[model samples]
Target chain A: MTLVKVYVNYKKSILNPEAQAIHSALNRLGYSNISDVKLGKYFEITVDDDSKDIDSEINEICDKLLANVNMESYRYEIVEGANA
Target chain B: MTLVKVYVNYKKSILNPEAQAIHSALNRLGYSNISDVKLGKYFEITVDDDSKDIDSEINEICDKLLANVNMESYRYEIVEGANA
Candidate 1:
């Protein structure tokens, strides 16, 4: 088995409503200095073995589907593992 | 300033199409053993210095905005920083 970790986020230049909401929530919770907020996500994927050159294949996936080139940024790391 | 990191992910029980695409990419790239894939994202936010009890404030923000209790999960870490 192969383990992959992916990180995706909105580009810095874009406005994020979700982040803004988070900022207000922080304000209500009592933090006065929290002028801004940005939200992000993380994921782990486990793949079964059917191919040979896994890393390159995964990078292709990132380039094509896992990431949106227009507004989001993403990076992935691979960790070889013992599983199905 | 306060540095906040949020990690949001789909529950294990959920189906992730992004992850599925990544899996195929890995297969194409040469990792034959990779049968499945899951995608996730990460974000870093800087909050200005204005509140006391920053940790609790950030936690509340997480509960309200950064995380989705129904399908996605989130966790945050605060790093005291040398900036506004």
Candidate 2:
């Protein structure tokens, strides 16, 4: 099996209220050193080894289901032996 | 500035309904090669340069706010020059 790690996050132009809230909360909790915070989605997908063109398949999956594509962008990395 | 990437996920013993839902959706979408899916939260935190002992500070933050230590576990990587 091949393990793919995907990260989906809001575009740079978008204002993430959740991240802002977290930053404020961190400040309230006395972590004043935190300058910024960004919240995103992470997915670990395991695919069968028989598949061909894993890169295209992963991109298609991300585009179709994982990421919104309009306001969010995604990136992925494939690990050859990530059965664990 | 330092960029810390934090990944928070449910422990192996915990049941992840969201991941299961996604897996089902993928199967419905005809991605039969997919074997498993795991979903989690990803955070990008930028910290001020003046902070001393960044490792300990990040650990404290993760323990106190970023993750629920009981059901979820978190790991982080510090990227020194990640201003972009």
Choose the strongest candidate by DockQ: 2
Q: Model 2 - which docking category? A: high
Candidate 1: misplaced stretches above 4 Å? A24-30, A49-52, A80-84, B13-33, B39-41, B49-52, B80-84
Query: Least lDDT summed over 10 consecutive residues: which range in candidate 1 chain B?
Result: B34-43
**Clashing pairs for predicted structure model 2, backbone only:** none
Per-model DockQ: 0.53, 0.91
For each candidate in turn, the TM-score is 0.67, 0.97
TM-score of 1: 0.67
- The deviation in Å at residue B46 for candidate 2 is 0.4
> iRMSD (Å) of candidate 2?
0.6
Candidate 1 lDDT over residue span B1-84, tens digit each: 677776777777878777686567666866566566655556576777766676776666656766577777766777778462
Relative to the true structure, how large is the alpha-carbon lDDT of every model?
Answer: 0.67, 0.94
lDDT of 2 by residue, B26-75 (tens): 99999999999999999999998888899999999999988999999999
For model 1, the DockQ equals 0.53
Estimate candidate 2's alpha-carbon lDDT, on a 0 to 1 scale.
Answer: 0.94
Q: Looking at the true structure's interface, with contacts defined as alpha carbon pairs within 8 Å between chains A and B, what fraction does model 2 recover?
A: 0.90
